[model samples]
Target chain A: MIHAIRARIKQGHRTTRYPDEPMTLPERFRGYPRLDAGACQDGCTKCAEACPFGAISCKPSLSLDMGKCLFCTNCIEACPKGAITFTNDGRLAANTRDGLVVGPDTERVLARALDNKMLSLFGRSMKFREVSAGGCNACEADTNVLSTIGWDLGRFGISFVASPRHADGLWVTGPVSGNMLEALRLTYEAIPAPKLVVACGACAINGGPYIGSPDVCDGVDWTLPVDLYIPGCPPHPLTILDGLLRLLGRIPEK
Target chain B: MTSTMRTFRNGSALPLGDVPVLETESFLKAILDATVHGWRVSSYFGLPRGGGLRIYCLMSSDSRGSLGMAAADVAGNAFPSIAEFCPQIQMFEREVAEQFGVVFEDSPWPKPVRFERRLTDRTAAGCRTGRPSDVGVMEYYQVKGHEVHEVAVGPVHAGIIEPGHFRFQCYGEQVLHLEISLGYQHRGVERLVLGGPHPASLHQMETVAGDTTIGHGLAYAMVIEALSGTMAPARAHALRGVALELERLANHTGDLGAIAGDVGYLPTASFCGRIRGDFLNMTAELCGSRFGRGMVVPGGVGFDCGPELAETLLKKSAAARTDLANAVELLWETPSVMARLENTGPLTAEAARELGLVGPAARACGVNMDVRRDHTFGIYSMAQIPVATASTGDVHARTLVRWLEAEKSLYFIDEQLRHLPGGACMGKSNGLAGEHIAVALTEGWRGEVCHVAVTDDAGRFARYKVVDPSFHNWPGLAMALRGQQISDFPLCNKSFNLSYCGFDL
Candidate 1:
């Protein structure tokens, strides 16, 4: 125990001071994507064709759906016109589903916190029940990491409860598959009324890479009414925490 | 013995027509003989041929460092079950039957491998036979006694982990039998990868079991490169090796921490948890994603390591290594942690070998089998790390083996980074050779990850089989739980940490 204490003391304060202080992300960290429609050559469908998931649509203007994007930057490489680039900003979560869509003119898409009425109920404390429906476990793993001492999600009054009965909302990850659809619905129903559904990662919002697979239901929006969409193949813990904080009105909307 | 089966080296693509197609009886005899003579079945699956199924078995001769492939065409809807002679092939046979509707005549424990609903729907493209039962609603082994009781634990667990059903028949606190039923995380990964290296194939491979992204990604990349008759650059191989070892370091650290947590040891649990994140952050530094998702591509790695980044990695890994040693030493020294781990969930070497266990679980049982050493590939062929093992075959053995391996992995990363080859991290991959079969094995942090891809005449994948180590080790976990305390199930389960989705797939 003494040795552990000594080790802990030596590795002092590993936790990131996010919300209160800015977190330093790596240089290559792919986050919110920026689109330049004018840079695209007329009638070129390179970016759309390059996307593993149909996250990009060329014919209807160069729009990148952050919800479906894996943040793999495959489109950026395939786009000879340099039409799409990812900004290092990790705050890509949004309150509405349509808000996740990034057009050429859109500079940034920030997650708006809940309305004043909803905030009053869940603003101070929000416990979530995480249900992984056909998720790859990446999103789930990242979410669990938030509970670690470094992230200390409990510090923000956001905790993942074991039982749905204790939850104020459902934090759903993965593309909802036919097998998990019933269980997911049952889990959502188990939560009390006036509950929120926060879909984390690209798979939950728009099926990410497993987009058109018949096995999956595309995203959680096909079943539950998603209140928040956190995008990434598996969004970093910082991104997930930022979204949850914004949802609970803990972090001020940018 | 070698004359009966055709042999090929690891990562070599053989012409589809070159594999010797033996008579059904002879094929069965050959597989049984190989297993009896110490060769293990690496992969066993069926491919569609002339509206029927052609069974292929890939056996690995670990000592010889060669792989054997044998094939047999099913005459009708049923094939003779070799699983009785070679118990290791039972699950593979069941999987083949579940997917292709081939009946294994008079086989013991014949049941659906994944209990997939689509496999029962006749309208489904690959539904050759069998009706889909409700997932996790199958007959389980029961212990009938005055005070015997059955405890059922989730397809939805209390912990923030993936879903899988565990049924334990216990008398008081002692477990008589544990049956693991998993299909909950099934997302038709194999079905999704059928036609071609579809745009989503690489991404699907990465998520086969999300934790082993680099492992599966490396295996799939090797499969593509093998089939295409190309090799990744030396620098690319080095980068892949770095990523793979980093993955091992992170996961091992986390598993050790989780094991400590399961036993109620908080210090190591908390400290190792943070250290695990440090390793993941190092990976994020490499490829911008914590899980190393976008780091590995087909031809080579997606990211490059320059001198400055290499120096940073070396420094960070050195720090993590020191921190991990300090944290994990506490688990070894503390008597409470030691008591909870030692002799709990003991899997004998005999049982482990018979069950065809792979990875650390097998190594913990003193089985000297590691894909990286046995089937050399990438930088592993150039630089070898000693395979760590323990004879106890308990939670402690698994824990110790992981720590030792993590130490080696850290050393490996430091060495590789300090002497990183200066060259392109990717190479040109031409179109795959048509009508060929390729097998690629990677020693993923968990265990051996095998990817076998067979191409059509048009250079597209006709059949792709992924054998996650969890497929071989989940049974070992079940066997370990026998005659043990029921409460230790979580500890035993963590020691293996088998992937439900990987197995379900």
Candidate 2:
């Protein structure tokens, strides 16, 4: 008991005050991206060719699909003119799939509030059933990290419930492998109507690494409509939180 | 080890022709002989050919400090099952049978392992085989009696975990038998990497078990490097070592906390949970991904660390170390935790060995089989992390082994960071040597991550087999459940915490 108390004292109050306060991410942490399509000298498709998943294309106009991006520096490394770079800002979520697409025109497409009914229903307290369709456990791990002492996502009145029947919506990740599609559908069906579907990670938004494989159906969006798309290989906890908070109209729209 | 087999060290490439294609009897004999001679079966899988399949078995010996390889080209679909004599190869043979449609005659568990065959292949093989349409749909072994009941749980579990089904044969509160059905997470990784070293190969490796990014990633990278006839620079080795150990620290801390959580202990669980994130953030500090994705690249690492970052890691790791010690010690100090932990799910050393368990579970049973020390790869070749072991194979033993390994890993990380080698972290890659087989083994946080890459004539991958530690340890988990209280399932399961996706892959 004494040891527990002492340990608790030493590990005192480690939760972050983000959204209200400025989030301090690592220097090397690749989050939101910056693209300078105009900087290309001639027909430079280096970034597009360099990308493993074809997330980048520079034919008529250079554009990046944030949903398909793995956040790897392959594109940035391949670009000789230094036209592409990833910013430390991790707010790369959007309400629509097109919103996740970035070109010279699209500076940033952030997630917006769900309709007033959603705000009235789930703005205060929301329970979700997280389904790892074909997830690589990273998304699942980071999602679980939210419930830990530091993040304590439950403090925001957002919690992952045991059953989909009790959940307000579905939180999906991975490329949605064929074997898991039935289970995911059954889970999504179990939740009450007017439910939210938030797809986290590149896999959940677009088939991240396992794209084009016959084993997986593209993503959760292939079968079910995704209300919010948080794009990262596995989105950082802050990114996930920001997406959640933004959906609830909690954060002041920038 | 044998006249028919060819031996090579880990991370070393051998010409594929050097491995003698023995007759079926000799192949089985060589494998059984190698096992009797104290070599562990690292990887055994059948590669598909025209009509039949070629069976290859790779074994590693800690005492002899070598890896041996031998193959047999089966003319037709059938191969005589040695899984009857060697229970260790049961899962591998089952996997072979499922993937290539080869029938392993006279096996104990003749069921499909991970349901690797596609519907088209299943139909093409023979529709009359009557295979299940989907993964996890198989005939489960039933224990029938007057008061017997079966409890079937999940492909969709309660927790935020990958999917797998578990059927428990129960007599009231006591579980008589437990069978785990998986393959929900199979994305055809081995099949996907069949052609050239596709751009998605490294990405696939990183997520083979995302928590084990450093482990599997390192193994895959090492295989690529060996094929290219190059070694990652010393500095890269140092950084990879640090990343690998950090991964160990993060996962072991999480497992320790989870074990504590299972016993209803809150303080340690809560503290270690945050500390676990701290380690992950440190990994994020390395290559931006908390899970170490895109960190381990072929020929070297993707990122480099300067002195400033090394010092930062040193300080951060020290802080995590202190917090981890404080938090974990509470579990030891707490009598309730200890009472709940000790002798709850016991596996004898013999059972662990027979079942071919690896990683912490095998170590807890006093199997001194850490690939880092035994089959020394890049950084482990230079410096050694002592194999942590415990004699009593129980939840308490597993927990103790994990905690001990965590401390060692912390020390290792500190040592590697402080002495960060000078020079380039990345290296120039030469073209891959054709018709070569390289067996790369890494000591992942879970266990030995063995990746065997065989290059075709045009310097492309003929076959790539990844044997994640979960493949070896899942059966041990089943054995651990025998005759234990059904309520203790969570505690016992947490103790092993094997990767479902890694196993399925």
Candidate 3:
């Protein structure tokens, strides 16, 4: 056991120095959805059809509501432009509600607007209790890995609690199910006031392939109001790590 | 014994019995009688376009492997019920009744068995009334006792796991009866296999259950190959075996880590998790998928096992084996883990047999059944593997079995790679005509994965039935949970690692 611990320590710091330097993501990590207008046809509506969360729309032109987006990458995957690159640049936040927008090519426009919003501010910490509505456990695996000895996310005062009652934030993943709808409501109600709900992964933000299932609900927002949405099929561990830090106000809004 | 393939060239056979083609009532009785005689019903075939509802029952000991065939014309009978003899058939029968309205006489439980009853009503807007009926409302057993409070846990849980609901009838933590409700992760994969794409689109068949991708993919490819009389090249076959063994090793290592973690053995969990990560990284190096994706394509592999990837895999496997051995040894020194897992969730030999449990779950209980060893497929026949088994059916035994098997898989992969012949990796996969029905059974990490597929005149998928290992082992879970404390549930549950999505679909 001592040898194993020594081996891990000898491997050096495997954790990313996120606050000090830019974090490098894996090659194929699902970060956020990007819109490619050039590759999309004038009324193809493929993106909208592909979205289980109704995250994409083409009525007035392409529009995306990141708040509602599940980050499933299905829209980007279906986009013929070779247009979408899985980039890990989600640092968008706002004090006012109107900052959220929707429309075709909005991701490109928001990309520039959010660039200045990455303000690096540190503040109070909060506890998160994760729930897998109907996830494949990929996101859950990544969630647990973030808190290992290396990342030491607890140092940021960002911790995953065992129960929702003591939690300041409810971290939800997977597509909500018909049977779980009641349990979800009870959990949200059990938590104290000033509580927040963050929908993680494509399944939680949107149903993904399980959208039309008779057993599952649409998404977290469809059941309860969501405070933040981190989209990805199974978002990269670093993406989730960053998202949680941002929620705690420790991450700066650049 | 050599088995000859039954050529269903004209039309696939249905359950055979006395029935007026138009009368749904007598037809239902005929099918029920067949099922009661120990006949394993394979697939339920419904042709809304052809005004047909059929159940194909294949008798295992029958001559020429003939499938007793029977059909009920739903156009003549509005409702059909066959829930009495084969209660399990309610799902399929109700599906047919909701969609096609073939009424069966004297069904013990008669209600819409698949869809929402009110919505599936014949006059509902845009609802397809030509298919079977909807799902019936779930019935709860009545108990006369002290209040009998019910506590429901999940669709979502506090831990890192899939969605499933455990409704416990308890009196202050001491549970009375535990009822499990699942299906939260249903993705309609079987329906996706039909109409919208060609049979070649079966490439995604592996991804249905991400962790068991290689196993399912191999089974799907084998079914296609069997139907079309195609054989993958020797090199591809070797590569497939290599992928399968790697998959088994990765899963077993990770599961062993989790099992240790559940008992609060952090040293083993941390070390094994890291080792398992190395295994996954090796997989990513070999195939684009970190979880063995795109390794098994129909007819053969899409990519060859190049020297560089094979060499990298070999090095990684060696390192993983060394790390795991040392970690497990350290874990053995810790008495706390042993105290928690040693004799928990014991499944005796008799109970194991009665439940028909397969793979590691059965092996851990001394049943000694493994599809790879019993009825070999791919290169396993040539690999000449001895079945892994343990007499004690506890969590500890399962963990030991996994550890032992991980080493075996690593050995198998090394042997396969060394003797891998130099040759082509693919073959022709075209011309799937006649009533081509084929089945492929493989030993996935979980257990036996059986896939049966039938092609129509136009070569479209007439019916496809996928049976994951979880289907048979789920009953085993209910048995294992018996007389055990609620806290031990996680340890017992992790021992099986049953895939929720695999069974949901």
| Order of quality (TM-score) | 2, 1, 3
* Interface DockQ of candidate 3: 0.21
Higher-ranked by DockQ: 1 or 3:
1
Residue range A139-217, candidate 2, lDDT tens digits: 9999999999889888889999889999999999888877777889899999999899999998888789988776777
* Local distance difference test values of all predictions, in order: 0.87, 0.88, 0.62
lDDT by residue (tens digit), candidate 3, B1-505:
1122122311122212221243455555655555444333434545433544454322221223333444445455655455555654644555455445666567654544323322122231221112321222356433447865666676566665666667666655555666565655554456555542242244336645667778888888887777667878888888888888777877887888788888887777766766666666565555544566556877888667767667767887887787778777765666778899888888886666555576798889987667676556778767866678899998888888888788888888888777787888898887654455566767888877767666766656666667677766765776777667777888888888888766665
Model 2, position A15, has a per-residue lDDT of: 93
Docking quality of model 1: it rates as medium
lDDT tens digits by residue: candidate 2, B261-380: 889999999999999999999999999989998889998999999989999999999899999999999988889999999999999998888888999999999988888898888888
lDDT of 1 by residue, B1-505 (tens): 4787889899889899888899998899998888888899999999989888899999998899989998999998999987777778889998988888899997887887777643323234321122332666667878899999999987778878888888999999999999888877777888788878988899999999888999999999999999987779999999999999999998999999999999999888888888999999999999999999978898989999999999999999989988899889988888989999999999888888888999999999999999999999999999999999999999999999999999999889998998988889889989999999999999998899999999999999888999999999888999999999998999999999888878977
Q: For residues A1-254, write the lDDT of model 3, one tens digit per residue.
A: 56657655644444558767876543433344455556666668876776545666676666666545534345765666654444456443322223334443453322111122222221345677877665655556657666765466877867788777878768787676444455567778887776778777656775654554444565777667776666554555656766666655565545
Residues A46-73, candidate 1: write the lDDT tens digits.
9899988888898678898888889996
TM-scores of the candidates, chain A only: 0.96, 0.98, 0.75
Global CA lDDT of candidate 2, please? 0.88
Q: How many clashes would you count in candidate 2?
A: 0
Off by over 4 Å in 3: A1-124, A148-152, A177-182, A210-231, A246-254, B1-52, B57-137, B141-152, B169-176, B196-207, B224-236, B293-295, B302-305, B381-385, B416-434
